[model samples]
Target chain A: MNWMTTIFYFFGAITVLSALGILFTRNVLHATFLLMLSFFSVAGIYVLGNASFIGVTQLLIYVGGILILMVFGLMLTTKLNGKALVTENHNRLIGVLLGTVFFSILSYIIIFSANFEMLKSNKTLPENAVEFIGINLMSNYLIPFEIAAILLLVALIGAAVISEKRKEKQE
Target chain B: MSTIIFFLPFILIYTIFAVYGERKISAFIQDRYGPMEVGKYGWYQTVADLLKLIQKEDIVPKKASKKLFLIAPVIIFTSIFCGFVVLPITSSWEGTLTQNGVYFLLAIVSLDVVGILMAGWGANSKYSLLGALRSVAQIISYEIPVTLSVLCVIMISQSLNLQEISYQQGILINAFPDMENVKNYLFGISALNIDVTNWGGVFTWNIFRAPVLIPVFIIYFISTLAESNRAPFDLPEAESELVAGFHTEYSGFRWAIIMLSEYGMMLLVALLGVILFLGSWNTPLPNIGNIMLANWTTGEPETIAGNLWSVFWLLSKALMWIAVQMWVRWTYPRLRIDQLMSLSWKYLTPFAMFLIFVSGLWRLLMI
Candidate 1:
């Protein structure tokens, strides 16, 4: 295989393997780190696909910000005792059956979709995707962009309100 | 890959010197000679320390998460090295991976937080954990202002490429033909229009491009100081409070690697400030015909002379900033945690946002 294909497979394998590792890992901290690896590998795939901005954004927001927060939360909540953070499985047979069915359906849809042919063809992105994105956000996609901002503002306010109420209740 | 081969040795040597410089400067500030015994002027002190540190036993506490603890330093050091890959050292000397260089650097830099968190959590020590949490909160809060300040410059430059930003700063701000016309100019009263033909060199730096951006530049520098965990914003790693902070449990080569990475990051931020605000690699004077300063002559980028001068100027500017950082670290008392958070969220953040708005308006109306 060509080098591009090899690199693509390498990223794909890393993404899939680390995601599975997260599911199987007993320790919450180990699982969180595995999740980070999975996210980073996905970012690698995005970079390989010519979505450089999206790739870096994924790395910055997911791996850097959100993952750190997750790990921080885990570390703070856990006790000092070196306990193996394993959870007992309930209804494992049902979970396995449902998971298999879900995978089968996903693969069937992917194989038969009309967009499959188009996905096979490689299309080069614009040289200045960031500039294009900025112009589009300001022009055609202005409404949705503003809506996203408003949504984020609402979330921020909600979080503050909830936390303030908690503090009052504690007092 | 080849860049890494060349860069590794350079960074290794640089970290040694930087460590020595930091120690000597701190000593001088405290009214004492630092590292006087090791070699002439203590230049060999860092070398000796490195040798000693390398031979020391690598100890992992029984309670520590062995895997995470072992990998934390490697990840931290590697992430810093990864950042160097996109740094536009001299345009020609830049690594091949320069696409969206600023964004890439930001991403790589943020990865260090993850490494620090891992180190703190994996060590199974309360001090390390507390330091990690403080670092996380401080870095996250400080990052907002730093990003906004950079965006202010980026808004004006209209490009994410470091090379492009540096190239835009080439135009001189020499409104006056002669240097003697400034006698009557007092209290910021001068009609200095940006002149592309006559290079006013240092005056074309982003900080001086517009009056409002001066605040933005100051805010950026302050935020960088906090981001890199330097004083007076170094509450996270306050030695007296946290006992060496997140790496308290680490020893030997692992601890040395962590220190090296910290110095690397300090240099990284310094270099970014140079590129973004201080006019990267551009000399103070335009190339005067016939009578040139020989080795210090500015050349068109990509030529041999240009390459040499670019490295020279950029390195000098970055080193100057690093010295300032060291000076500030020694001079100021560490801020309290509450004060640090307030400085970031209350003052720096709001002011940065205002500066961004004002700079945008300035660019729109004036430029």
Candidate 2:
């Protein structure tokens, strides 16, 4: 159809393909990279859907932060004995059953409950989504926002304390 | 898309001259001549090196993972190149119309860490793996301070769009009538009785607009230095220790691509620093009484002359900073890993957090 639709389909295809690739790839490192690709494609879809702040944040947190940490952890843990790091799947029957159930539920929601007509109509989103989000967070969602901040602060302190205890034990 | 096309050639040419410039600067610092055999004043030395690298054998290590090894440089170059897409080069010529331009630039740039890791692990070398791990740790740790410092600018400017931030620092405020409140104050002081909306210069820049930002700018510069893996923060690629760090196994054209992206990262951070603190593309000349210097310097945004002036100012300022990066690189010895971590976490991060609070107070009380 339109260029935007074409681009959306392109990103969606990558997301799906990369997800499948991650599942099938034997090399653990390759799977991790494929996961990064899938996350990136999903971020692309978010940007295409006019949620750029969410898209960039997804990139910042997932691709940049978490994925780098994952790669770091993988490298540090994997013994480099002149061999590729490989993974083998376990509980295949249960995995397939769970995956099928989740897929069917998602498909059912899309097919039976979704309003395709409303999606087809050109409903304009906010011009400045960041400003809109910021306003809502400060005004309407202030209590929840502050609570989340406190929760994160607590988690941060907990991490520091845990690490400090380990250091003390080693001492 | 057009900006990408324009920037590809600009980056190539920039890398050429920057490589030569870095050599010459280092040579000057060491009291020795650098690259004397190429073109006039050794201007074509990097060009010759480029030619040589292009013809060299492209090498992939024997035991390396072929796929990731081959793709790592591409990922590294692409992620850094993508950062340029959101950067506003002139008042009228931003690459993309992203509302969250600053945030997008930062997020995309951080993706390079993934590529560096890929390069490191894919290389299958002890040196490469160690280098990549060190790089990832340093970059991840330093990002906190850099983001926090940038948050200070975002708080003061009240916008994340790079172009809007640029416009706020110039005589161009007349174009946005809604920003009258911001324009009325000179250096965030209404009592000055001097409207700096027409005055575009150092006085109107972010460092002066909120003087608390001076220390914030210093923190930003230092953190960015670490982010780009330049010295004295270049422990990731410490030549004495790691023999090129994460890119140790790369060779020929792939190595050239990594080098190009490394220089590109430097330019990108320098340009961002200019935009966030120095003044973006706005002229440094201010309008003194009866002088109209700023008016004479900056042209109308729609005009070709204006675009040229904007490009000239922005590039000159950014290039000056890049030179400073090189100067600092050669001046200071590479920092040890523990010192680097402590400098970032203990010093820069706390200072930046304090400045963010000061910025909040400044925004609340001053403007």
* Winner by DockQ: 2
i-RMSD of all predictions:
1.3, 1.0
Per-prediction TM-score to the true structure, in the order listed: 0.91, 0.95
- Tens-digit lDDT string for candidate 1 (B31-70): 6554765578877777788889999999999999899999
Q: Give the true-contact fraction for every prediction, in order.
A: 0.73, 0.96
Grade the docking of candidate 1: medium
| Residue-wise C-alpha lDDT for candidate 2, range B146-228, written one tens digit per residue | 99999999999888888888888888866643676566356666566666676777777888777888999999999999999
Clashes of 1: 1
Q: Give candidate 1's error at residue B55 in angstroms.
A: 1.1
Q: How accurate is candidate 2 locally (lDDT)?
A: 0.87
DockQ of 1: 0.69
lDDT of every predicted structure (CA atoms): 0.78, 0.87
Q: Write the per-residue lDDT of candidate 1 for residues A59-92, one digit (tens) a residue.
A: 9989988898888777777755557466667898
On TM-score, the leading prediction is 2
